[model samples]
Target: MSKRKEKTSHGFLNNMNFMFREQWNFEKTAFLFALVFILFDLTVSFIVIWLPKVVLDSINQSISPAAFITTIGTITIGLMFLKYWSHYSEQGVLKSAVNILNMHFYIKKDWKILDMDYSLSSSAQGKIKIERGHNATSRNIYVNMASFYPNSAYLLKAIIGFISFSAIILVLNPIIILILIISYLASAYVSFLVQRMEHSFKDVRAEIDSKLYYLLEEINHHAFAKDIRAYNMKSWINDTTHLFMDEKYRLENHIQTKHFMQGLFDVFLFMIRNGGGYVFLIWQMLTSDMTIGDFIFYFGAITGFSEWLKQIVMRFKNLTNANFSVDDYRYLMDTKDASKRTKGATLPAYDQPAELVLENVCFSYEESDRVFINQLNLKVYAGEKLAIVGANGAGKTTLIKLICGLLHPVSGRILLNGTDSKEFNRDDYYSLIAAVFQNVSLLPMSIAENITFCKESEFDTERLLDVIQKAELSENINELKDGYHTNLLPSITGNGVNLSGGEIQKLMLARALYKDAPLLILDEPTAALDPIAEDLMYRRYDKLTKNKTSLFISHRLSSTRFCDRIIFLEDGQICETGSHDELMALGGKYKEVFDIQSHYYKENSGVKLR
Candidate 1:
């Protein structure tokens, strides 16, 4: 096998062993069921083969009627029990196993996402790989892990059946048995090759599908609805979809055509194997002194043995495909995010107010020339309220991400209470932050549930209601029939409570306050609201934060005056810093931008901003 193929096979077997280790005791229980079913079914099958011969022989010998009836009844009872129980056990085992494996994969994936290096999730290539790992579940031809156990069991059972039946056929004619086995095996080999060829394009297909998924999301997005209609994007959407669909269609069509031809060859091989058996059997019967019952039994056994061979081959093909999927899944589980360290590190520094300091922090994208942060040195004392203001490309948002531990500086260290941010346990470090972003995403859930983001067992209803009131959302929520329990969705079929932009921002604020993290970061949370409301929110920010160390980012410089300290970011560096009044007195970049924004609002009834 090629290196890649070898890895796929190795991964497949490795994961099977992993499954055993994960739930070894339970797997043995399932395998026990399989063993009983296979053994019983095998015995019943041979009895079936011998039944017709036994009946004919008894009739010719004039056997006792009572004995014959007893024999037939016994065989019939065995067959009935084996047939029903075999199906029941196999399906029951399959369903139970699949559910367990699905849950395991989910837990594993969630853990990886929660603890992975921030860089992996934040970068484009990393995102693609993460998606591929996600697609590894339920994306295989046989639904990834779904086919593995059943296919392996089928192969094992077929092998046992083949050995038992082939012994009978060999005595009749070994040459015929050998030729038929070879032909069937060859056909299966070809089929396996074709299947591997089909799976090769899966990654490319996943990439195209990801892009298409994004476009579909864009079209259906609630915020994009008005712009889509007004901008006449419907046709563009259809045309774009067709462009991608055409490529997918062409690729799939080509693969299906090749598979179709291979399938026909397999059919042709089956015909020759069966027909040749018929021709050989007739000649043997006429030439040899084989008894009528023996002749009939041998011929039937030969055909049945060939069927076992075909089944084993089919199982092999399924096994090969299933193994490739296991490879995909394992690859994802092992993929690392290199931004965090101390894999099992714990945080003993939590619960105290966090002092954040940046020591010559610099950040930039690998592909971009723009340095988002350049040798930036700053201190956010515990219980401080700081605002960061900048132009569109001045990297206010990037700075927030870096400080929040969602993005690490390319160079320099960030000190979290004297310890480097990367050295601290990432999850533990994350527990200190509560961020409300400009584009806050709400789940399709109840209002209170969205606020708390907690399960029922951990819910604090009184605390939730208080946060809602503080965020100025209590009145709006109370207006609804369901109040705090109102569901947010596109799928309530018009029954859902559709929150406005300001309401959404308020909801985001409610969540942040509910979290009560020491370091609260608001990335322009009020940028979408009217000027008066924005000003009101800025005034209330201190109260909401409880004077905890907070970093707020906004392009609207007027709304930032209330913060204790304001930093003006220009060209990826802090060009000016001090209180709003102090910066204005300096007559630097901060003063220039603030005046420009202040003049525009003054000329427009203080309702609009520049």
Candidate 2:
């Protein structure tokens, strides 16, 4: 258990280091943008503080109104130009940073969840919350962090302005400067108190994310609420979703109330600062140390700094809250469990007729003590077509995964041509094998692209046409507007039409036929097809896989007749094995299941047998 945790921690650290290194580029760009904005802010602060004093002096000394207006207007125009430059510079850098970060995300996302170490993948599942949980976690992590820079820049400027004001006041009198410092510290304490409340209020965000994930999954997995209405489950889901939203608002409202009270404290602080400044000014006046213009300048400067100081405190508090999102995003991107099998041995040549030998293999889920596959031993030789037949809950799929190097057996080992499967590079091994499962996955692409899977640029188009012909899908393709060039999903690309269930099966068969791998594994491929299509598909499968190594897993007993050998699996163990004729002669589990299915097919096909 300690070893498992140590490995998980190492994986998380690796992912975190990767995320932060990518994030650094974004941080640099934001820094440049924020630098420019901060400069503009400093300029504005100086202009606003001094301009009022200049205008008031001109008025008392009988200076021309026209001159005063011209000076103010010129300054305002200059400030406007600076503001535009700041805004443009900030936006441009942020957009660039987001693009670079998004590119990294796109490249890394193709790594499958199943490929990671079990402990790491389990940890990643919680952080990234994929599927119905973490799938909706925003892809805008970079943009969100980049956006924080502009606000931080404004906050920095406010701090600088306050410091400048403090310096000027100190020159006026030390006592007055001391009072203002005290008031500022008091205001900061209030901000910290309010930030704690905000932290508590923000706890509902994860719950909101979870609720959104389930709602999305239900709508999509249930076919956009149509199935929900069919089953009359709309009210239950609706109420549950609403409850989540209400809880989110409840938290948000709590934060707002705390902020409002904080605002009240700010107002009171403002009154104290202003009232205290006036008393000091009166003392300065009595001592005959400063001019009326000097009094006006210091008073205005104090007011300006106080307002800006409140803004600074407020932004600092907001930054604290923003860190929650930053941490959440960092956790998702940096979780080490996302990367595994950094290196492995290269797979050997398939020339030796790659035999799969599982010698007492075993496996279990993350927390499970009971093994899913226990001391399981099996073998399938090259050039021999084998069938793995089992009920739904039997470990048929699990066994196939073990062979494909997708899952590592917890105990014992899987071998290919007498070499341990784990010793070979998993990616290279996968390239040598072709697998189609009950869950058919077709990319949204052209019919030809889907068939070729973008792997071979120079495929035998003639062979593809031959496979389509054998699969009996020629008429369907000819009826299509674009034929082979037609898009598989017209809804996305407007090039192809939707395929019927039978047509999809034929297209899938064409894809598998085109690969012509040394070992072809088909998992319940004909389950959705009609008897005629299924029969035709099996014939095509026989022609395509003739003399090549193949493993066909099917519930239909008629399909197993094409195999050179059959292995009947039950409860993760091979209960029976033989040729179709030999199996029937045994008159065991195989005979009972096969005879029943064969009789049903015979009745449906209107065929009679002695």
Candidate 3:
């Protein structure tokens, strides 16, 4: 137990020091001012206690001297101005520190989330970790930072005043100080218990708040507003919110009731403490040669001592709570990015077909026993258009992710041009591939900026126009009010135009063409379009791919006929591989699913099967 306590103490100090350096380096002067002003604030309380003693003694002695009067006046004005300046500077310093730390931590967290390994962000457990990591930032960590500056200083002042006042109480009567110390300690322990209990439930509260925020978002958000109203889910939404809050408040009331009981006991201890001290001090005055000023000084000192002790105790409690946040923040930062572990000495090439090879590669989502890809050994030669056609959940997209280095294999190596894909710098490897996912999304930005995903100054206008023409988005672009500069949605600019489903898909295709990476991945790129529109896009696939190595994933097998080769997947394995004619003659799973799709299309088209 002692070893564990010592380790926790060491960790607290270490994490506090790291936070000071990580955030406060730039605002050292503000932090220093905050510390100094806090000491001044503490000093004024002692001065207040001293002034009354001196003034009362002088009047009792019948000293009517101007010097004494003038001295009192001077001290009064001096202390007033001192307090005012101290307060002004403290606010100034604190504002600077708060603003800087918020920005500094924001930048750090934003980058950390952006740079975190996709494996961590892609899983349910990993997302919870990310939220916890985010909690370690912003306001919870803000309190920890405050503890380092103002709170620590407040604690220091409290300690100094507590000790000084205790000495004065001892001078009056040693037994009195001892009794008060015991009482103060007992009260402090009760307070600590109350605070610790509250702190212990903070994680539970945080989880509730996180879920509530998401639920509220889903209710109020544009994405669900139409559907929710159409479904008439208002009552269900209200019920869910009410149940969540009811549980939260029930837990809160339970803690509050416990604190109330503790408060009663604390009050009893304080009444005994205060009553005992008054009796002791009054008895001393009656029997001993203690002056009137001594009586006043000692009484004020005793009261001040108790106040300082409580402040000190509260400061300790604050530090203990803040340390938990620091621990989480530190843990998150210490977790290394998975891709950073294997950055070999190479940058993947640009403007060349990326030759990808998978040797017994496999992968699965975390917390799942079922494999998504199993022993997936395959080779994709440069400049080959390999169409991956499979049933739903056939690992088509997962295979593309592994080949493009968006995901790493679990058991075997994936190499590109004979060099291990994981060995290359992640940024450079990702730069080699351009992918359009099944879910097409556009940022609330200018049409040109969406295509470029870069600043207008950096964009190549000629190449962008060429890609837009190739993507068949030029006709739609011409219809917009601001032309290339028009915003895609009203989420940003009020005059933004919303595109039709097919137009949005075309815009995404334009983006992929604009990237023109060596490797292209199209996962159900034409899912939003009609059959005729899909065939039109399919006819242009060869032109769009040109010399680049491309992996096209689609459920519509008719599109695979244009590819150089095709692979059919089932139950986490590649079941067949061949061209359309070869698969048809072989009479495999590929041919059977293909014929089913073809027969349906032929019936709809009123055309004979070729």
Q: Which of the predicted structures, 1 or 2, would earn the higher TM-score when compared with the native?
A: 1
The lDDT per prediction is: 0.79, 0.68, 0.77
Candidate 1 structure quality by residue, lDDT tens digits, 81-179: 888888887775676567656766656776786667766765665566566666666633255655677777778889999999988887878888877
lDDT of 1 at 406: 86
User: How far out, in Å, is residue 388 in model 2?
Assistant: 1.9
**Which regions in candidate 3 have their CA more than 4 angstroms from the true location?**
1-10, 65-69, 140-148, 184-210, 239-265, 341-343, 595-600, 603-610
Error of 1 at 1 (Å): 17
Cα lDDT of candidate 2 equals 0.68
Compose the digit string of candidate 2's lDDT tens values, residues 1-610.
Answer: 5632322333423443444466565455655666777777677767766777777777778877788789778878987887788678767555654664455443343343344444444432442433312321245533343334444566777888778787887787777667766887888888878865554433245547656666767777634567687889878887888887787778778778887887898788778877888887778777986767677787777777667777777666655444444444444444453212446565556543467788988877555565667778888887788988877767888788667666677789877777777665556667778788777876677788888776346667888788778767789888877787788776678665788877888888787777766678888888877666676777778886765678888887777687889988877778889898899899989889877777656733624455
Model 3 TM-score? 0.88
Q: TM-score of model 2 relative to the true fold?
A: 0.79
RMSD of 1: 3.5
Q: What does candidate 2 score in Cα RMSD to the true structure?
A: 5.2
Better of 2 and 3 by TM-score: 3
The ten-residue window of minimal lDDT in model 1 covers 344-353
